[model samples]
Target chain A: MNSRKCLAFEIVANPAAVDALCARAETWLIEGGLGTESFPVAMLLRESLNNSMLHGSGGDPTAQIRCHLQRGRKWLKITVEDDGPGFDWATRLECRADIENCHGRGLEIYRLYADAVDFNRRGNRVSLRRRIAEVMTS
Target chain B: MTTVQVQKNDATVTLEGALTVALAQELRPQLQKAVAEGVSSVVFDLGRADVVDSSGIGLLIATHNSLKTKGGRLRVANASPEIMNLFKAMRLDRHFSVEGRQA
Candidate 1:
């Protein structure tokens, strides 16, 4: 085996901080020869981190949200983990049958954006992946 | 949630900020009032919205359905990039004339 070199970032769960994280991720990816995948990866990262901070951490200002970004020549893997109660991805994404009204579709949206999603035992850990081949770079 | 007071003549309806659920109670009256008042178009500004989930997108769809009968049109503007991206991803901007929230 060669090596699974990685880059990780611990980001606070703040809406305002999303833009900067996205910019950094894109910049890093581009400088590493992964430019075209910039926008989708950015979107996936922001949404996942936002969900972790909001739902996973329950808007706890003090709660810590950490993001791990791993990319290689073939794929980019993004993971978001939080220090809070993990939620059930399946149940929450389901529409409420009893209630006539509902709010929030964050998880569903994230699913739509991420190519593949996986959760962990604590439920606080989530991993999403996208193929580098599909992204365009100039 | 933010509240937007839409004044259509005698009818005044309030739309919740980053609308996600379409409560007939608030939306219908406002839309009806706009029609009753001969308002040419009903514009909703989403500039203040930092984020919008699917429920919110549902509300816009519901509003569009309701307004189609009145010969009145619905418009969305001021969508922050956050919301704008969602709209772009879903092609909602094309489905509706979501002008810039120039606000």
Candidate 2:
């Protein structure tokens, strides 16, 4: 467990910071022999982080977010925490097919792309996991 | 991050780049201007778009609904495999006119 490298960091709750986060995560994953997993991993990171920065913290630049990433031979784990009131993660996780609806699709994207999506009881924190081997095979 | 290049073939607008949250806000003005002139058909050329996140999807849907109110249609063309899969996975393909280049 300790043998595998883990990365943890924080970013201000600002959309502009997402690109750097994605770049850092993608580079880390690629360096870990998970380059093929970069797209989904990056996308997942962007989606969750976007939600955290925008919706969770209401785009408050002063608010900070905690991001943790851990990679193993077969799995990758991500958790994003924001300093804002949480939402009903259970209800919002459903995939809304209404293309006319302008919002509420972020969680659905998570469910579709990630192997599992979970949130803290407070809902301000989100956890995402992906099966690296499964993503590569698929 | 994303640029919505308007070819303006009367009403079509081509979009290229990574359509994520970082760019969605910047694109709204262009899209609004395009729709303002009562453009009947709006086409999003996503062939060069490497990524489309939920914000992108929302923008597309909003643009679709806006065009619909004017009796116009929105078409998404040349989406990458990843974007196409996103459309299908979210069942947005059924709602938007998504046509893969290979399809």
Best prediction by lDDT: 2
Superposition error at A114 for model 2 (Å): 1.7
Error (Å) of candidate 2 at residue B100 is: 3.3
Point out where model 2 deviates above 4 Å: A1-4, A95-97, A134-138, B1-16, B101-103
TM-score per prediction, in order, is 0.59, 0.86
Tell me, by DockQ, which candidate is best.
2
For model 1, residues A1-138, the per-residue Cα lDDT tens digits are 322336677767765465467667878877767776665676678667767766777877567788888876668899989987786866665544221222344554666567788888767888998777744443
DockQ of each: 0.18, 0.69
lDDT of 2 by residue, A1-138 (tens): 342368887988876677788888878877667888877887799888888888888757878999999876678999999888986877666756555689877877787769988888889999999987733322
Task: For model 2, name the residue pairs that clash.
Answer: none
Worst window of 10 by summed lDDT in candidate 2 chain B: B1-10
Per-residue C-alpha lDDT of model 1 across residues B1-103, encoded as one tens digit per residue: 5454555522222344435323323454555555666654556666655445454565665556556666656678777665677666666666567655554
**Candidate 2's residue-wise lDDT over B1-103, tens digit each?**
2344444534554666678876778777678788886566777788777777888888888888888888878898898887788788777777668988775
Which residue pairs show backbone clashes in model 1?
A36-A136, B2-B17, B20-B55, B20-B56, B77-B101, B78-B100, B78-B101
